[model samples]
Every structure is written in C-alpha cells, then in structure tokens.
Target: MMERRAYPLRISAVVLDAMQRWSEDELRSLNAQIEFVLRDALRRSGRLRPPPADPMDDTDGD
Candidate 1:
C-alpha cells in the first residue's frame, strides 16, 4: 500500500504560472507536474541520495 503525505509549500506567482502552462502544454495533471518538478529539484540539489532499503518510515504511524 502506498502511504500519503502532505507538505506546505510556498511558490512565487511566476513559477506557479509557468508550471500551469507547462502542465497544460504537456497534457499532464497539475499534481503530477508539480511532483515531477519537486523530484527533479531534490535530485539536482543533492537532497535525495540513494533510496533506503525500506522507502517508508513508519514512526509516524499509530
């Protein structure tokens, strides 16, 4: 089963508009485009290294 997470993100109007245009042009969902961009940014910024053996952390689970 896939786990769901939520985050608060702040973005500039110009960047948001660009993302909207890019998503419409590519016929991709807004959520998908945003996720793709975020993943690319994380990789480029070296924030995401190799995946852990278990990708999910259950410490937050009840």
Candidate 2:
C-alpha cells in the first residue's frame, strides 16, 4: 500500500459547495472527487502519468 499523508486544506465555502455537488454527480466521496479532478488536471498538464481505470466506471455497465 502506498503511504498516505493527511494535511489540512483551507477552501472557500463556494468552492466546497461546488465540489460537493460534483461529487454527488460522480457518485464519489467529496474528497475522492477532488482528488480525481486534481489528478486529471495533473495528467493533462504532463505533471503526472494517466491513472488506472476507475473502479466506479464499471458500475454503469452493470
């Protein structure tokens, strides 16, 4: 397992509200949804490699 670190983040209420809405749309936890968005942006910017397929995507085909 990869080591995970927890750090406090300060975000505006409006941004947090938007993230909450987006998380519900994607059926993901709010924190996971934020991470997903950040990872995608990183990959697009060439700062990170593409991530593995999302397990959540499989649910829609069932």
Query: lDDT tens digits, residues 1-62, model 2?
Result: 34678878899999999999999999999989988998889889999965577766776756
What tens digits encode model 1's per-residue C-alpha lDDT throughout 1-62? 54669887788999989999999998998778998887899999999776656656667676
Candidate 1 overall lDDT versus native: 0.83
Model 1 residue pairs with clashes: none
TM-score of each: 0.58, 0.74
Alpha-carbon shift of residue 36 in model 1 (angstroms): 0.6
62: Cα error in model 2, Å: 29
Identify the leading candidate in terms of lDDT.
2
Give Cα-based local distance difference scores for all models: 0.83, 0.88
